[model samples]
Target: MANNDIEVGSRGSLPRKDYFEPLPAPMIDMEELAKWSFYRAIIAEFVATLLFLYVVVLTVIGNKTQTDPIIGGNLCGGVGTLGIAWVFGGMIFVLVYCTAGISGGHINPAVTFGMFLGRKISLIRALLYIIAQCLGALCGCALVKSLQRDRYNHYGGAANQLVDGYSKGTGLAVEIVGTFVLLYTVFSATDPKRNARDSYVPVLAPLPIGFTVFMVHLATIPITGTGINPARSFGAAVIINDKEIWKDHWIFWVGPLIGATIATMYYQYVLRASAVKAIGSFRSTPPTRH
Candidate 1:
C-alpha cells in the first residue's frame, strides 16, 4: 500500500473538525477585568446601545402618531407596523456593523449572556456589558423624552406591554421564542467556521442577525411588543413609569435569559465540537500523558 496510491477521492465522507470552544474555567478572570480593551468594549456597548434605543424609540413614537390619532404627530406619514419592524431591523444591522469589531455589537443583554455561557467571553465582561447596555438604554430613552417632551408620554415611549387578550404566560412565551431565534442567529453568524468560509462577504454576518430581529419584531410586536432584549424592555419600562407596565416586567428578563441559555447549550454541545481546550482552563494538571 504505497502512501501515494491509497486514495485521493474517497475521503469525502469524513467528518470535519469540531468547532466548539469549551467553557473557560475560573470564568471570572480578574486580569481580563483590568485590560484597557475591556473598558473600551464597555464603552462601545454603551454607545451602541444608546444609539439603538434612541433610534428605535423614535421610530415607535412616529408609528404611534400615525396609528393613534390621539398622538397626532404622524412624522412618518403613517408608516405603520411594517415600518417599525424595518426600523428595528435596519438599526441593528447598522449598529452591529459599526460595533461588531469593538464589543461584539451585543446591544442585547440576552446575546451577551449567550456568548458567556459558550465561553466566548468572561463572566465579568458579560456583567459589565449588561450594566453598560442598561445604562445606555436608560440614557437613550431619557434623551428621547427630553426631545419629544409631551409626545414622549403620550406615545408610550415604545415600552413593551402585553396587549389585549394576551396573558403573562403568553407574553413570556413570545419573549422566549423571539429571543431564541435571535440568539441562535447570533451564534450561527459569529461561528468561527462560518466566518472563515464566508470571508469574502465581510458584511454578511450582521445582515442575517439584523434580519432575525426584524422578522421577530414583525411577528411579536402586536403581542408582547417584542422583548427579545431585556435591556431594551427595561429601559422603556423605566421611562414609561407606569406601575401597570412594570407588572409583567419579570417576563422580559426571565424569558430572554432562558432562551439564551437554551440557544447556547444547543450551539455549543450540538452544532459544533472542537479539540481545543477551553481558554482559561484552571485544571491543576495538564491532561497530557507522561
Candidate 2:
C-alpha cells in the first residue's frame, strides 16, 4: 500500500524538538567562588581574633584584681601566673574549634606569618590576614580601655614584660621554644594525613594544642609573662602604654616566627612525604573505563 519507489530510510533526519529545551542555568566559575570563599574566611579570622583577645584581656584583668589584693597577706588572692597560662590555652582551644574551618583559626599574627613563611598562604593573602588580625587585636584593646577607663591604673590588662631578674636573651629563648611546641601541634592536628578522619581531629586537635599553650605559659610566665603571641602582647601593651613593653615586643614576634617556620617546614617536607607519595601512586593508576 506504500507508494512505490518511496524510500523512508533515504530521507535525512530532522532535529528533535527537545534540542531547544532550555539548558540549565550557567554554572558559576569555581575560581571566582573560591576567591569569594577566601574573602569570607579572612573576615571570620578577624572576628575570631577579636573574640579571642577580648576574652583573654578580660580574664587577665579579673585575675590581676584577684592577685593585687593580697600584697603581703597570709592568703594568696590571685590564681597565680600558672592559672593565667591555663586561661590562654583554654581560650585558644575554644576559638580554634569555632573558627578553624573558616579561617584556619589563626588568631595570632605570629601564627599567620609563620604559615606564610612556610608557603601555606600567598603573600597578598597573608598580608590581608595580618592586617585583619592586628586590627582586631587593637579593637579588642580599645574596647577594654573604654570599659575600664576609670580602672586602668589598677588592671593593667595583663601586659607582658621581662621579669626583674630575666635578661632579653632568656626571654627570647623561652618564647621561641614555647611557640615551637604550639605551632608544631597546630601543623600536626590540621594536617590531613595526621588527622585523616575529620571527626577524630575536630575533637582531638584542640586538647593537645591547648594544653601545650598552657604548659608553655607555666614555664615562661615568670620570664616574659609568656608573650608567645605578639598580637596578644601588643593588644594589652597598647592599652597599658608601657614604653618598655613596646621596646621588648620585637622578641615575641621574632621568636615565634622562627619557631613556626621551622616546625612548618619539618611538617611539610619530612612528616608528610609518605602521604604525598601515597596520593601520587593512587593518581597514577590507570582507570579501566568500560
Candidate 3:
C-alpha cells in the first residue's frame, strides 16, 4: 500500500523539487590558464558590455539634444523616456541571447558578482569578467563622446545623476531595489530545475529579465537615472568628469552590490535549499615532520 501510494503521488500533478547545484570549492588551477575558451568568454563580456552601453548612452544623449530647443528644436523629435527604457531592455535581451552560451551573458558587474556569491562562477573568472566589463564600458562611452563631440557636452554625456528634489538616501534605495529585481530574475530564470521541468523555458528566458530592466527603469529613471549597473555609471562618470557625479558615485557601486549579495543568499539558501546536506568531506593533507 505504501509503495502504491508513492507511485500514485509521483504520477500526480504536484510540483517537483527545485534544482540546486553543489557549492563549488575554490581553486586556482593551471587548467584555466591553458584553456582558450576562458579568454573567449572574457572577450564576449567585453563586447557585450561595450555594445550595451554604446546604444543606450547614445539614446540618452540624443534624447537630451532633441528636447533642447537651443539645439534640435522640432527636427529631432527624440524617442522620449519610454523609448529609452525600451532600448535598454531590448539591448539586454538581444545581447543575452547572443552571448549566453559562451560567457553566461553577464553584461553587468553586479550580475557577475551575484553569480560569484552563488558559486555559479569561479573567483578568478568573476574578477576577470568585472575588469572586462569596466574596460568595455569605458570604450563604449569614449566612442559616444568621440562621435558626438560637441553634442556630448551639451547633453551631459549620459551621466547618471541624482535629480532635483530627490535625496541621496532615496536614490540609493532605488538602485538597490531595482538591482534586486534584475538579479533575482536572472537567478530564477537560469535555475537548472526550472529548465529541466519546462522544455519551452529556454526560448523565453531572456524576456522576463529584459522586462525587469525595462520596468525598473520606468520607475527609477527620474530619480537616479536608473543605474542598476555600476560599470555603466562609472563609465559615464569618467567621461563626463563631473564633481556631482563623483560625489554620489559610491551609491551606484554600494547599492547594486548589496542587492546582488542579498539575491544570491536568498536564491541559493532559501529558494533552492542548497544547505540541506551537512555531510563532512575528507581531503589529503601534507605529512608533518616528526
- Identify the candidate with maximal lDDT: 3
Q: Write the per-residue lDDT of candidate 2 for residues 1-290, one digit (tens) a residue.
A: 11111112223653222111122122333353468777887888778778778877777776676656444422266667777788889988888888877778888877887777655666666777788887778778778777877555465666887888888898888888888888888877765433432337657777787888899988988888887787788777877887777888888788888778777777765775533543453344443322
Per-residue lDDT tens digits for candidate 3, residues 71-103, read 546644888888999999999999998988899
For model 3, the stretches where C-alpha displacement exceeds 4 angstroms are: 1-9, 12-30, 72-76, 278-290
CA error at residue 134 for candidate 2, angstroms:
1.0
Candidate 3 structure lDDT: 0.84
Candidate 2: stretches off by over 4 Å: 1-34, 70-75, 197-199, 273-290
Provide the lowest-lDDT 10-residue window in model 3: 1-10
RMSD of 1: 6.7
- What is the C-alpha lDDT profile of model 1 across 217-263, one tens digit per residue? 99999998888998999999999898878888899999999999988
lDDT of 1 at 29: 84
Measured against the true structure, the TM-scores of the candidates, in listed sequence, are 0.85, 0.78, 0.87
Per-residue error (Å), model 3, residue 81: 1.2
Give candidates' CA RMSD values in order.
6.7, 14.4, 7.7
RMSD of 3: 7.7
Model 2: how far residue 172 lies from native, Å: 0.7
lDDT, candidates in the order shown: 0.83, 0.71, 0.84
